[model samples]
Target chain A: MIEVNYKHKLNNFLLDISFTMPDKGITVLFGPSGSGKTSVLNLMSGLGNDKNKKINSRFIINDRVIDDSINRIKIQPWFRNIAYVFQDHRLFPHMTTKQNILFGYNRCNSELRPEVLIEKFKIKELLEHYPEQLSGGQKQRVSMVRALLSQPELLILDEPLASLDYTSRQELLPYIECIHKELDIPIIYVSHDIKEVLRLADYILIMDKGKIVDQGDIADLCISQPLLTQQEGASFILEARVTKIIEEDKLVQLDCGETILITAESMRLNDKIRVLIHARDVSLCLSPPQDSSILNCVPICVDEIQADENGKLRVIAKIGKQTIVSLISHRSARQLNIKKGKQMYAQFKATAMIK
Target chain B: MIELSPILVTLKLATITTLILLLIGTPLAWWLSNTSSKSKVVIESIVALPLVLPPTVLGFYLLLALSPDGFIGHFWLYISNTPLSFSFSGLVIGSVLYSMPFVVQPLQASFEMVGKPLQQAANTLGANSFDTFKNIVLPLSKRGFLVAITLGFAHTVGEFGVVLMIGGNIPEVTQVLSIIIYDHVEVLEYTQAHYYSIGLLVFSFIVLFVTYSFNRKLMVRL
Candidate 1:
C-alpha cells in the first residue's frame, strides 16, 4: 500500500490530503480541473518542492519512508524508484524513439529487455523515427515503454489520456490495461473524466478543491455517492464475469450475482469486466416481465427509497451484495408499491449499455 | 607584395583568444543561465561591463595591470621569467576580456532555449546534471556554439584600442593587422593601409557569410 499525507498552502486553499492506495491495482485520483489532482502527483514524484516554504509531508510506499518532514528525510526523484508518465509525453526531441525508450533502461541497469517492451507497445516500426514524427497515441505508447523499462516499483500516470482525441484515447486504453494485467505494478492515475474513471479505476479517491471528500471501491462509491447520483446522468459499475457467449444472438452472458445478459460479442468466456450502468437506464417492476424486449431483468431486494430535491424518486437496491440505483418518478414508485426490504425486479435495456 | 606577418599574427591571436574564451565562458554562461541565486545579477553585470565601457578605459587598466611592476605582470614575472607588458600573451588577455560578452551571451541564450523540461526528464531517467548536459543539452545547443565561436573570433580580430595600449608595437609578435593598418596610415603609406583594410573587410564578410549559412542548415535540422 502507498500512504500519503501532505499539507501545503496553495494560492487559493490549503491543500490537505491523506489516503492509502491499494498496491496492486489502478487507484484513480478523480476531481474537476483546478482541484489539485496534478499537485498530488507532482508531490509524489518529488518534482516541485518550494524552497522558500517548508512543506509538511509524509509519504511511505510499502514500508519505505520516501518522505518524512518530521524526520527531515526526503529522497531525491531519481532514487525514489517511482516512474512518471506525463500528459505531454515529454520525450527528448533530439533522440530517436528507440533511444528515448532506452534512456531509462540504460540508466536503471534494468534486466527487463527493451525488445520485449518495444514489441509489447508495438513501436517496432517507429523505433528509428524521432518523437516529432510519431503520432500522439504513438508518443504516449513510447513514453509508457520508457517508464516501464525503468523497473519502477510504482508508476504515476498523470492524465496520460487527457490530451488525446477520442479515437487515440480509445487506442491507448488497452495498453494501459495491459500494464496493470501483465506487469502487476501499482499505478496512481489522475483524471477528471468520469467515463475513464468508471472504466479503469479499481479504487477511487474523490477530491473537491484540495481535500479528499471520499474514497472507496469505485462500484460502491458510484452507487452511494449523492453528489454523483444527483448529476445529469449518474452511472455505477458492476463487477461481473462472462459465463457464456451466445454468438447466434450476438450477446455475452454475465454472472453479476444473477444471469445478466448484455449485447456484447467481442468478450470471451471467463473474462472479468466492470459494467457501467446508468441510473436512468434502469427501471423497476413489481414482477419479472416475460414478454418485454429488455434482455437483463435481475431480481433485487429494495434497500431504500429517497426523494431527490428535483422531485424524482431515487431507488437503491441490491443484487446479492452489490448495490444498484434507479432514478424513477415518485408516481411510478407509488404505483409499483416499492419499499425497503421488498422484492422487486430491475430491468435495463442491454443494447443501451452494450455495443 | 603585401606583408602577411600581421595577418598571421592576428589569426593566431584570435584563434587562441576564442579557444580560451570558450573554455572559461561556457561554464560561466551555463551557470548564469541556470542559477536562481541573487548574486547572479552581479556576475552578469561584470561580464557585460566591456560591452558598454570605452575600449580605452579597459586598455588603461590593462596597461597598469600588465606593467612589469603591476600586480599581474609581477605575478607572471615571478612564475615564468617573462614580464606580461608588451608580450603576445598580454595581448591575448586583453582580447579575451574585450570579446567576452560576444562569446558568453549567445551561449547563455542557447542554454536557456534548451530549458528545464528536457533536463528534468533526463534526471528522472537517472542522468545527473553533467551527463544530461553532455548527452542532451550540448548537442541541442549546436547553433549557439557556432554563433558564439564566430562572434568571438571576429571581435577578437577587430580589437584595436586594447591591443594598441598593451602591445607596444613589437614586430611579428604584437603587430596585429589592425595595429599595422594604423601604422601605415600614420606614415602616409596610403596604398599599404588600403590593401590591409580591404583584406580585413573581405575576410570578415566571408567568415560571417559561411557561419550564417551553416547556422541556417543546423537550425533546419533542429
Candidate 2:
C-alpha cells in the first residue's frame, strides 16, 4: 500500500492532501486541471518538498519503509523502486530506444535484461531508432516499457495519454489496461479524463484544489456524494461480467446482478467489461412503454430526487441495490408526482452505454 | 610558388586555441546559462573584456603577466624554470582570450534554449549530474558547440595586433599567417601580403559557410 499525508505551500497555492492507495490494481487520481495532481506525484517521487510536521508516508513493499517522513527518512527517486512516466515522453534524445530502455535496467540491482522488455513491448523493430523517429503514441509506449523494465514496486503515470491525438489515445488505451492487468505491481495514474478513469481505475481518488475530496472503489465511489452530485458529468460505474454474446443482434449480455444488454462491438465471452451510463443519458418513466425504441428499461424504485443547477430534477433510482442516475424535466417530474419511494423504470438507449 | 610553412603554423595555433576554448567554454557557458547568481554580470563582463580592449593592450598585459618577474611568470619560473612569454603556448593562450566571446556566446544561447524539462527528465531517470550533462546537454547543443569551435578558430586565425605585440615574429615558431601578411605589407611586398590575406579570408568564409549549412540542416531536421 502507498500512504501519503503531506502539506506544502507554494507561492499562491496551498497543497494539503492525504490519501492511501491499495497495493494492487490501478488507482486513479482524478481531478480538474490545477488541482495539484502533478504535485502529489512529485511529492511521492521526491521531486518536491513536503513541509508538514505530521507528514507520514510509506510505500510498503512487503513491510519495507520506502518513504517514512515521520521518521525523517526518505529514499531518493532512483532508489525508491518506483517508475514515473511523465505526460510528455521524456526520452533521452542522445540514446536509441534500446539504450533508453537499458538505462534504468543498467542501474537496477536485479538481473532482468532489456531484450526481454523490448520483445514484450513489441518494440524490437524500433530498438535502434531514436525518439525523434517515432510518433507520439510510439514514444509513450516505449517510455512505459522503459519504466517497467526496472521492475519497480510501484508505477506512477501522470497524464501519459494527454499529449497524444484522439486516435493515438484510443490506440494506447488498451496497452495501459494491459499493463495494469499483466503486471502485479500497483499503479497510481493521474488524469483529467473521466473515461480513462472509468476504463482503467480499480480505485478512484477524486482531488480538487490539492485536497482529496473522496476515494473508494471505482463502482461505489462513482455514485456517491461530491463525485456524482458535485461533478458536472459524473456518472455511475457498473462492473459487469460478460455472460453471453448475442452476435446476431450485435449486442452483448452483461450480468451486474441484473442482466444488462449493451450494444458493444467486438467483445469476447466472459470478458469483464466496465460500462458508464452518464446521468444525462438516462430518463425515468412510471411504466415500461412497449412502443419505445430504447433497448434498456431496467425496473427500479426511486430512491431520492434532487434539483440540479438549472432546476432540472435528478432522480436516483435503485435497481436491485445498484443506484443509477436519471435526469428528468421538472415539469414531467411534477406531473408524474415523482418523489421518494416511487416505482419507476430507468430507460436508456443501448448505444448510450459506453465502455 | 609561395611558402606554405607559415600557413601551417597559423592552422596549428588556431586549431589548438579552438580546442582549448571549447574545452573550457562549454562548462562556463552552461553555468552562465543556468545560474541565477548575481555574480553572473561580473563573470560575463570579465569574459567579454578581451573583446573591447585593444589587442595591443591585451598582448601587453599578457606579456607583463608572463614575464620573468611578474606574478604568473615568477610562479612558472619557480615550478618549471621557464617563462610562458613569446612561445607557441603563450600565443595559444592569447588567442583563446581574444576569441573567448566567440566560443562562449553561442554555447550560452544553446544551453539557454535547452530548457529544464530535458534535464529534469534525466534527473528522474537515474542519471546523476555529470551523466545528465553528457547525455542530454551535450547532444542537444551540438550545433552551438560546432558554431563556437568554427567561430573561435576563424577569430583566432585572423588575430594580428596581439601576436605582433607578444609573439615578436619568430619565423616557424610564433609567426602566424596574419603576422606573415603584416610583415609582407610592412616591407611593401603587396603580392605576398595579398596572397596570405586572401587565403585567410577564404578559410574564414569556408568555416562560416559550413556553420550556416549545418545550422540549416539542423533546422530542417528539427
Candidate 3:
C-alpha cells in the first residue's frame, strides 16, 4: 500500500491530503480542475518541495518505507522505483522513439530490456521516427511503454490521456487496460474526468479544493454519495459478464450477478463489460407493464428517495444487489407512495447501456 | 605579395588568445549563468568593462601593471628578471582581457537557455553532476560554444590599441595582423594596409556569417 500525508501551499491553493491506496489495483485521484491532484503526484515523485512538521509520507512497497519524512529518510526520485508519465508525454524531442524507450531502460537498474516493451505497445513500426511524427495517442502509448520499461514498482499516470481526442482516447484505452491487467505493478492515476475514473479505476479518491472528501471502491463511492451525483445526469455503473449472444435479435444477454437481460449489442460471450446507465434514460413503474416498448425491465426495491432543489426526487433502488438511480417528480413519487422497501419495476431502453 | 611571417604571427596570436579565453571565460560564463548571488551583477559589469572602456585606457593600465616598476610588473620582473611590457606573452594577456565579453556572453546565454530540466532529467538517469554536464549540457550547447570560439578568435584578431600599448609595435614577434595594418597606415603605405584590412574584414565577415547561419539553423531545428 502507498500511504501519503503531507501539506503544502501554492499561491492561493492549500494542499492537505492524506490517503492510502491498495498496492495492486488502479487507484484514481479524481477531482475537478485546480484541485491538488497533480500536486499530490508531484509530491510523491519528489518533484515538489516538502513542507509541514516532519511531513509523514511513505511509499511502502511490501512494508518497506521508500519515503518517510518523520525519519528524515527520503529516497531520491530515481531510486524510488516509481515511473511517471506526464500529461504532456514529456518525450525527448531530440530522440527517436527507439532512443526514448532506451533512455529509460538504459538507466534502469533491473535487467529487463526495452525491446519486448516496444513490441508490446505496438510502436515498433515507428521506432525510427521522432516524437513530432507521432500522433497524440501514439505518443502516449510510447510514453507508457517507456515508463513501464523502467521496471518501476509503481507507475504514476498524471492525466496521460487528457490530451487526446475522443477517437484517440478510444484507441488508447484498451492499451492502458491491458497494461493494468497484465502488469503486476500498481498504478496511481490522476484525472478529473469521472467517465475515465469509472472506466479504469478499481479504487477512487475524490478531492475537493485540496482535501480528499471521499474515497472507496469505485462502484460504492460512485453510487452512494452526492459527489458523483452532481453531474446533472444520473450516473450508475453496471458490471456484467456477457452470458449469451442472441444474434437473431441483434442483442447480448448480460448477467450482472443478479439479473440477466438482453442488451442492444452482440458482445462476445463471457466477456465482462461495464455499462453506464444514465438516470435520464430510466423510467419507473408501480408494477411490470404488460406491453412496453422498452426492452429492459427489472424488479427493484426502493433504497431511498431524496428531493432535489427543483422539488424532483432522485430514487435510489436496489436491483438484487446492484444499485441503480433514477429521477422522478416529487409529487409523482408521493402520489405513488414510493418510499424505502417499495417493490417496483425500473424500465430503460436497451440503447441506454453505453458500451 | 605579403610575407608568410606576419601571417604566422597573426595565426599564433589568434590561437593563443582563443585558447586562453576559452579556458578562463567558459568557467566564468558557467558561473554567471548558474549563480544567484547578489555580487553577480557587479561581476558581470566588471567583465563587460572592456566593451565600453577606450582600448587605449585599458592598454595604459596594462602597460603600467606590466612595466618593471608597476605592481604586477615588479612581481613578474622578480620572477623572470624582465618586465612583461612589450613582450609577446604580454600582448596575449591584453587580447584575452579585451575580448573577454565576446567569449563569455554567448556562453552564458546558452547555458541559461539550457535551463534546469535537462540537468534534472540527467540526474534522475543516474548521472552525477559532472557527468550530467558532460553528457547533456555540453552537447546541447554546442552552438553557443561555436559562437564563443568564433567571436573570441575574430575579436582577438582585430585587437589594436591594447596590443599597441603593451607590444610596442615589434615585428615578427608581438606584431599581429591589426598591428601590421596599423604600421602600413602610419608609413602612408595604403596598398599594404588595404590588403591586410580587406583580409581582416573578409575573415570577420565570414565568422559572423557562419555564426548567424548556424544560429538560424538551430532555431529551425528547435
Instruction: Using lDDT, give the best candidate's number.
Output: 1
* Candidate 2: regions farther than 4 A off: A47-74, A94-96, A109-125, A225-232, A350-355, B1-5, B112-114, B216-222
Tens-place lDDT digits, model 3, residues B150-184: 88888888888898888887778888888888788
DockQ of 1: 0.56
Q: In candidate 2, what are the lDDT values of residues B116-222, reduced to their tens digit?
A: 76776665666666877887888889898888888888888889989988787888889998888878889999999999888888888898799888764322110
lDDT tens per residue, model 2, A1-355: 6777767675557778877789889999998898888888887777654444245455455576767766867776666777889899988877899888777777677566666667666788899999999999989989998888777888899999999999999888888887877778899999988777777788988898878998988878776655545566667766677889898998888887678888888787887777778788898778888888777888888888887776678788787757788777889898888989988788874331223
- Give the lowest summed-lDDT range of ten residues in model 3 chain A: A49-58
TM-score for each candidate, following the candidate numbering? 0.90, 0.88, 0.85
For candidate 3, the lDDT comes to: 0.79
Q: Cα lDDT of all candidates, in order? A: 0.87, 0.80, 0.79
DockQ for all models: 0.56, 0.39, 0.33
Which is the better candidate, 1 or 2, if ranked by TM-score? Answer: 1
Per candidate, the number of residue pairs that clash is 0, 0, 0
Better of 1 and 2 by DockQ: 1
